[model samples]
Target: MPRYLISFEKGAMDHIPEEDFPEVGKTSHAVIQEAKDAGVFLFGGGLRYDDGDVEHAVVGTDGVVTDGPYPESKELIGGVMIVDVPTREAALEWAAKIAVACRCAQDIRKFMYDPDLIE
Candidate 1:
């Protein structure tokens, strides 16, 4: 089985007004429920939807802690869903559902496995 990560940016929905967030939330949650019912849902969660340090933690290799969101992008990670499926096509299908529900672009990435961890 292959695990896929489906993630989106927070500001990607800036075109959508804040008033419509509830509806978007409902739609996305529905997709998560569907994934759960299909037994492919591993884990999923939404970011704090803020640009503050409270929502994100950055730890350096030296164990130094930085307070703030990721500096690489102005937009933060809105949400992420992880699924384990049989093929890339299945993962893409799920990504499409999420993209439509969130009304935002989604990045679907394959997860590399640790051979030693596989029993």
Candidate 2:
């Protein structure tokens, strides 16, 4: 089995009206619950911003810590879901369901295999 990351970038849902957030949340949670019931969900959550500001920090090779994300970043991950599935097609199917629920497109990537990480 491989773990796939399904994520959407920040501002991806900006076009959605604020009043519709509750409905969006409801639908998205339903998808998550479905994944959970299927035993494919590992972890998932939406990032939180403080007063419309993202709270982040970057660390340098010299062990220096800088406030905020990388200066060159144009997009930030708004939400993410990790699922352990047997195939890429299964991951794609889940991502499609998530996209409809969130009303935003999702990016999917397979995690590299690591023997030590495998249970």
Candidate 3:
């Protein structure tokens, strides 16, 4: 099995009305539950960047920490889900369901295999 990362970039859902967030949350959670029941979900969560209170730090090779994301990043991940499945098609299927639920396009990428990581 391989793990695929399904994520949506920040601001992707900005067009959605604030009052609809609860419904969005409900639909997204339902999709998450479906994935969990299918035994494919590994972990998922939304990032907290809208609050302005979020602390950003970047650690350098010199062991010094600097503020903020990489200087080149123009966007941030809004939410992400990891699913371990047997094939890319299965991952795409899940991503499609998630996209519908979250009302945002999803970006999917397969994780490279590592011997030390649990399969």
Candidate 4:
């Protein structure tokens, strides 16, 4: 089976509120369980807004480490899910289901397993 990254887009942030994102939360959990039941879930979770970790760090040829999202975007990666599926179509199907549950658009991209590195 092929692996895919099913990202819950940033637009979904609009639905979040302190009042209790019960609906969204419920659906998210359901989706996770569904993925587990389908035997596709690998590992996934929501992204944090900020942390004490180095937001930006760099390593020269001398050897260094860096932090922060390589390339930043106005919308952050809200959450993620890794699943093993047979095809992109199948992943898209699952993404669509998640979109309905979360009431937000989802970005589903197939993971590249390049061997020869010929793109």
Candidate 5:
């Protein structure tokens, strides 16, 4: 099975939350259960909506500490799910379900398994 990451895109909440965000709590649990039954879900979670406040960058060596998201981007990671599926199609199906459930656009990406190259 291949691992895929499903992330919610930024600023998509407006469209889905106009009425209400039914995707939280109760509905999320149902989705988790469904994934579990299908044997593809490893773990999934939501991220707290926070501004870049309380964020800092530090360089460390030899057990020194660092505090930051490393190479920063305009958008931070919002939420994620780790899914193990037999194919990209299966992962996309799961990501679609998560998108509807989370009421946000989901970015589906596969984890690289090859060890020969470095990013």
Candidate 6:
């Protein structure tokens, strides 16, 4: 099976009013549940947005870990879901559903397979 990543940018849905968050949450959860029932969902969750815990680290070739988000990326992943489906179109369909439910744009990506990891 091929796995696809459905993701949205951090703050992408910030324009959504605080009062409407509950509804958005409910709608998104319903879609997630639907995906699970269809046996396409693998895993999904939102990232922590607090600056304190959102520390970045870089691992040097010398085996030393350093602070900072490497090249200093301004964009962060707000939320992501992994789905194992049969085709790219199916994944896109899932992303579309999530986008509508969450009231935000969603991106679809295929996971790079590592043969060593499988065997």
Best candidate (score: TM-score):
2
lDDT of each: 0.87, 0.94, 0.92, 0.75, 0.74, 0.90
- List model 1 lDDT by residue over 1-119, tens digit each: 88999999876777988899999999999999999999999999887745643766678899998766668636568789999999999999999999999998899999889778643
Clashes of 2: 0
lDDT tens digits, residue span 33-90, model 5: 9999998888888766567554545566777656665565456666788888889999
Q: Which regions in candidate 2 have their CA more than 4 angstroms from the true location?
A: 51-54
Strongest candidate by lDDT: 2
Q: Against the true structure, what is each candidate's TM-score?
A: 0.84, 0.93, 0.91, 0.72, 0.70, 0.86
lDDT, model 3: 0.92
Error of 4 at 51 (Å): 5.1
Across 1-119, the per-residue lDDT of candidate 4 in tens digits comes to 77888887544767567565787789878988998998988888877656765544556587865554445434566778887899999899888877777767788878778766522
Q: Which stretches of candidate 6 lie above 4 Å from their native place? A: 72-74, 115-119
Candidate 3's TM-score reads 0.91
Clashing pairs in 6: none
lDDT for 99 (candidate 3): 97
Q: Model 4 — which ten-residue stretch has the worst lDDT?
A: 66-75
Off by over 4 Å in 3: none
What lDDT score goes with residue 3 in model 5?
85
TM match of model 2 to true structure? 0.93
Q: Which stretches of candidate 5 lie over 4 Å from their true place?
A: 14-19, 50-74, 114-119
Model 3, residue pairs in steric clash: none
C-alpha displacement of 57 in model 2, angstroms? 1.3
Q: Across residues 61-111, which tens digit of lDDT does each residue of candidate 2 receive?
A: 999988777797557888999999999999999999999999999999999
Q: What is the lDDT of residue 28 in candidate 2?
A: 98
